[model samples]
Target: MVLYAPLLFLLVLVGVQFALWALAQLGVQYAANHALQTTRVSGGTAAAGRADAAAVLDQVAGQVVVDPRVSVTRNPDTATVAVAGRVPAVVPFLRLQVTTEVSAPTERFRALTLSLTSPSPAGEGDPR
Candidate 1:
């Protein structure tokens, strides 16, 4: 029984270490998916699109467990978003970092832009 106790404890420790690493990867995946959603909404624009994308990243950064170590970068031209962060492990001297990137097709808003340029904006002349 005495020998089994030490072996059991070691197994528990290893399990905990793996759990921490998994948690880190999950966090990164969550952030990456969120950032991708923002990029899709922003469409293909230089300023507004990037602004929206950044806002999404900021939201993820603020809410994730590893916010302090989180970093997000978005490339509008390529429609790609990357998220990276590290989660501190419960075990001393152990930590894990995870990163993920997603790319989406560009969305052109030329039709919307041109419509907005019309002399009379929508709902300006009609109440219905």
Candidate 2:
């Protein structure tokens, strides 16, 4: 039984660390997706999207993530959000990280116009 105690403790430590990492990853992914959606709005800006992502990461991830960073990119028609950070190491002197990105199309309104023109008044063969 004495020999098994250390192994059991190690297993529990690894399990708890993995669980925390998984939760942090999920939270970061969710934040990225949320930021992408926010940036997809007609008038949203990349800075705004980045702020939103950062806010969510801080709120949900807490200490699970270390050195977290948020990035946002925008094009004429699309927006993307990326979240990156290291998950606190389970083993001494080891570090593991996760990065996730989410993208969405921007929303906008467009105008439609229609015009009708009389067929060429004088077709070459038309009898006047």
lDDT of 2: 0.87
TM-scores, all candidates, are 0.55, 0.83
List, residue by residue over 1-128, the lDDT tens digit for candidate 1. 99999789878987876776676566556655665555555443334434544455455444334643333344544456565666656556766666777777655455553455557688688778
* Candidate of highest lDDT: 2
**lDDT string, candidate 2, 8-119, tens digits:** 9989988888897898899899889988988889999999998898888888888888999998999988888889999998867667787898888889889986668556
At residue 84, what lDDT does model 1 achieve? Answer: 67
- Positional deviation of residue 17's Cα in model 1 after best superposition, in angstroms: 2.6
TM-score of model 2 (CA atoms):
0.83
Which regions of candidate 2 fall more than 4 Å away from where they truly are? 112-128
lDDT of each: 0.58, 0.87
Candidate 1: which stretches are off by over 4 Å? 43-64, 67-77, 110-128
- As for model 1, its CA RMSD to the true structure in angstroms is 8.9
